[model samples]
Target: MKQNLIADYLSCILFRITGFFTCFLPFNISLFMGRRLGDLIYIFDRKHRVVACANIRKTVAEGGDWRAATRITRKAYQAFGQNLIEISFIPRINKPYLEKYINIVNKDNIEAAFKRGKGVIFLAVHAGDWELSNIICANLGFPFILFVRDQGFPRLNRLLNSYRLKQGAKIIYKQAGPRQLIETVNKNQAIGMTMDQGGRHGELVKFFGREASMSTGAVKLALKYDCSIIPTFYTRVKGPYIKVILDQVYTVSRSGEAQKDLRDNLQRLAGIYEKYIRLYPHEYLWTYKIWKYGKERELLILSDGKTGHLRQSESAAKLIIQQLAGRGIKTNLSIQEVRSRESRQGLISFKPDIIISAGSSISALNYRLARQSQAKSIVLMRPSNLSLKKFDLVIIPEHDNPPARKNVVVTSGALNLIDADYLKEKSERLKRSGFIKSALSPLCIGVLIGGNSKGFSISGRLISTVICEIKRSAEELNADILLSTSRRTSPEVEQVIKNELGGYGRCKLLVISNEHNNPDVVGAILGFSSIVISSPESISMVSEAASAGKYVMVF
Candidate 1:
């Protein structure tokens, strides 16, 4: 009990301090202070900052740039801070202030709607200066009721409500029954409501090209009272000036079917919100998770326990995810690493829209899982035993000379996860982490040594021959070598290569084994290497080298 009282007292004291700054400071000074506070919040609020960046990445403009998202996210925090500070000034607003600072555009629309005996539903969203919108309607002598959700802080909530009441706006908490809303409409009063936030159990509707749960309360109330649902918003024009835009008013559709009518009306409202938000994107609330559930498609990736195969499969899936995002769809990716048929139990709970895999080992598993989940099956490389028709999409390399088929997508080289941007980012990370010397980055040659495999044998002579060729090439190109072997490399082969490259001036050999492996080395090699040498045992490694646009030599 003592702790609770102490916390409440501290909260009230902090609230009073904020009120002092907002209430006493000049408008411009308060706005400036609010922006600084916002920047501080952006630094300290780590969780919300992550959520905001994720939301921004999910909705960045075409040709997605990370820097653009960063700039907008920063501005979004500042806009939110400005909104709060301006909302604090609501209690002091009157007719003179509205006339001087607020410009009401399209007043004719509201007047025409008011002529109809049924009340008007001012359908709005959480955009610029939305808290002050009620003052616009109330000061103009419109009988107004603002339906608000609690801010989760009791004292802060009451303080904000006091401001609203002082402006002659009636308060109706969302938790209170709809009886109050109906009574207000029956009395021919304007009801202000915002339904832009995702509502629990709300119907899924498209917003910003992605699905989000949207509340249909405004449509329902309009249908019930035969009222006009006016699309309205107040956008901040400058530091202390605002423009209340009264956009096109809509009538609820009474298509006789409740579900259809509700969905159509809700979609209409969401469309309007999307237009305004796009125009003033930074002004919209971004901290809220807009693309909530019911908007994501699931993709399952089947791996064959090979690093090269996993990289290829992941590359293709990454491209598909990007394409989906371009079309306003969200994707959830799940990987199932299958060593044998016994791994089937791992996928029982996963329901996928598409299944993708590389290597012939998991072809049968991919087919079975796709069939069971009713997902489109996509496989990379030609299968050894399974029929091609079993899979929906077959992506094969041009070197394989696959037969002409409707489901086949033949490419020039193997798909790989490495791209220019990815390489640059990884290189920066490696430089920061001190794994690769910054001076050697431009002239590094990576040797990807694969050992014995099916239909292939690695002899001691072959090892010596490859090592001599690598040494000669390194001398000719004046490059340092970053050599690594695969799981299939024999101990004799490792010793031979280690002995040869060990005494060389600038060479690093990583012997792969059961317990000792560094996944990051692969990224570092791809990022820094100007050229790559590979053994013929693994075609995936060769393909990845060529895909990254590196000069490749197969020994």
Candidate 2:
């Protein structure tokens, strides 16, 4: 603890000296020295350099190239250095210096906004000498309130605040709460706030196709007070010259739904930020962890090669995401289809909050991945080779009749992907594709046949009987038949069923696996059919058919 004080004092002295040198030197000379210092820091500051490179990789288009990421990371450090040196010159800036070195485009925007007397909310981000913005505004003789967050070091925060105050700007620390902001706005003073920083108490918005938490305070204030929010940014134009772009002003709706208004307004601000960042990618703060929340909450999906298992895992993941949305917990989901242990190697890089999968083929892999990543494993079926304790959550079908345990969740049938919305969507798509004989078929019968599986066998006579019964039943009910077979269906059984249903004009579709394996056939039939019939062999197929919420008959 005693060493901390000595180190802090030394750090303060170093900062003061750096400030003195930056202020004392000529603009161009100071910039060159700052860039050199940045290059030196890029070599020395290992942790921040790594972070900056990673962030650049996440945000840029060709981010996968290490060379590209490295170059950008170095430039990002240099930008930071240049910004710091310019901040040291804030006290020297005045109206005359601004006229020579600073150019504020679209000044008429703020001038017109001031005529309304509603207190404009200036939305800006941490990009390109942002400190100069407040000073320039104050030097323009506008009453401005700058809202700033407390820095890590109290002495440095004080020093920074003193510079802003000296430029005729009112400082409002974030911890002072909304009362100060309300009073300032009531006095018809412009408020400047940076909206891109991650906050625990804010809405999750997409910044660059990835979810990042954004502060909604500006949006809320704009909506509540009917204020105009002008999206603004400051960018460096060559040596010692700054260009401040004041974008078009936007007004938020008083939609009476506060949550939605807040989200939409924040989304608009985030969109503007994304645009400028794309324009000046290196000028933004790339070292900051913009996707910290997304990285923390990941949902990993492990899939066996079977279509049934993959569908089950994906459907359960969608449901989990839906539930999390209700509680305001945004999640990042990744699905991987694994055929062997080698396919699991990629899981080493991602640490998930929960790992989910279905079928016995992927149970062991799921457990291994969950243990390695320290995530909760959720198995969708009864595992044949592993103990129940190995999984954090085991969802078993009632037919298995597994022993009761704290971690076990017994479901009526297997979890399936046949939800009402999916059924409606696929059915409409198939109707438009001319696959369905009649989109408005009032009595379409679906036949889902499966072949040999655990304790079950398919025979020619059984196929004949099933086909005869289906034809007889369809005739009695005056229904159109849509029949399909699974991968497990035997060729001989398929032939028998086809022969039995020969010359039946009412059989609208017959998707024999031996001929063509159209993946959408089964889903389309299940979605559009009024009734479904399944051969009792594969539980997954039967469960999915029943989940369509039609009258399902077991043959």
Candidate 3:
């Protein structure tokens, strides 16, 4: 508390010094200095610069280009600097200052609203020159009250509110409860309140295609008191010149359902602000995390187009989706197939909360996209080219010799979609499709054949020997066999399997993957088999067999 008091005191002293000079300086010169100050801040304030750019990318640039978002961020900083300078010059604003630099459009809208006799609620957002609204309304002969909460810095808050009061505007503390507000409305007066940056307790509504918390205070007050709501906006025409636009009075709905009425009205009001922010991209504040508390999440999968890698990525994405769903959050998934090193397109507006990739080839792309969207990066395997510390989480097989690190998780084998429920579902589907014989013996063995790899190869003679042993065992035990080949199976090896077991009555199902494909074949094979035999060339196949809790042998 002591530290905060000292900081606030220093800030108040700085504000006083700035106000003393700005009050005397010409308006245009003050604005020019403010822009330069903003430029300096953009260069030095790395944290906020990144945050602002990320926000712009998600909304204004629609996640298309970082350079465009950076440009807008730079300009937004300058506009905010100018806004700060104008705030200090509030003491200098008078009738002549309003006439000279400020232009009011649709001044009669407030008049029309006032004629309703219930009072007017000036609905505004944190956009261009919002501080000037109260002064402008005061000068225009409107009975305006600035309803505001006390800021953290008491000294600076007092100084700022003093300036507002000096400009002929009445003040109403937000903590003073609804009685004061009710009194103000009963007097047929107007109260100005900003509706954006609703903080933690605000209502969740859709804004810029994403849900953001927005204040429903204005809408609620207008509804309860039967007041007119005017959607007000301020735009910078040029340096020191601003246009105050009063949109058509927002008609508050009385649907009789209280919560529905509140949300619907607030969402419509937020849409109005989104439209203007889209038009004047650089004028609005973009440094804050607009969707931080939102319940919606986006998940991106970076695929290298390899079947095994894609399947692993899908498994990770499924887990994440399930976890978020358990917490009552909605998730949207997008898959981008990375064909080349330069393949980074078509992710135009998706801002992901988590980015997942499987293979080494697409890890770099995953990192880049995660950094751009400010999302968490998760790689299934240890990234070959990038450091493990760069990713938020790295899952690598124990055989890969993964190092001990906080971010690294060592798994026994490759990730595959082969849980008990998944196996049961696929098995039932195969039985319904007549692929599995209903009259077959309960004792069964599953054979999964894989082909060439970097360190291993499958020969026709070797597969024939393996199939003969399997046939002998099947006949001795009176058991049925389910057999399938992989995409890598050579035609010679496939022909050997067909010759050995194709017409055998004990061989219940035989699949030549090179000729026919069944996505559920592997899972269905593992579903009901008493034992599983897999080729040593594919770790993914072996892993699936092991995960099925069946006895497995690798040939």
Q: For this target, which candidate reaches the highest lDDT against the unseen true structure?
A: 3
Full candidate order by TM-score, most accurate first: 3, 1, 2
lDDT of 1 by residue, 1-555 (tens): 676666666766665677767777888888887788778888888767656755664564333344566687898888778877777678778888888888888888888887787888998888887878877787888788998886656776777788788999888998984999999888877999887775667878877666788877888788778888889977778878888888866778788888888888889888887887778777877777675555577798998888888888999899899998997778999998778656765565565668999998779888876654446799999986999999999999998899899999998878888878877776677567654433673588888888888789888788898888878878888888887787778888878876787677767434354336656566667777888888886778887777778888888
C-alpha TM-score for every candidate: 0.58, 0.58, 0.89
Where's the lowest-lDDT run of ten residues in candidate 1?
A: 57-66
Better of 1 and 2 by lDDT: 2
lDDT tens readout by residue for model 2, 243-318 = 8989887778657788887887788789988888888877888766676665346898987777777778877888
| Candidate 3 runs further than 4 Å off | 1-10, 23-25, 340-343, 398-415, 428-441, 451-465, 487-516, 537-539
| lDDT of every model, 2 decimals | 0.78, 0.80, 0.86
> What is the clash count for each candidate, in the order shown?
0, 0, 0
Global local distance difference test of model 2: 0.80
The collision pairs in model 3 are none
lDDT of 3 by residue, 1-555 (tens): 898899899978977888889877888899998899899999999877877887889888744588898899999999988988888888888888889889989888877898899988998888887787778877788788988897778998888888889998889888985788899888999899999888889988899888889887888898898989999889899988999989887779888999999899999998888888998989888888888878899898888766667778888888889998998889999888778645566655567889999988778888887887778999998797899999999999999899999999888998888888999999888878776655557989999998887778899999989998998999899899999998889889999999988788898899898897777788889997989999997767888899899999998
**What's the lDDT for residue 320 in model 1?**
93
Alpha-carbon error at 283 in model 2, in Å?
A: 1.3
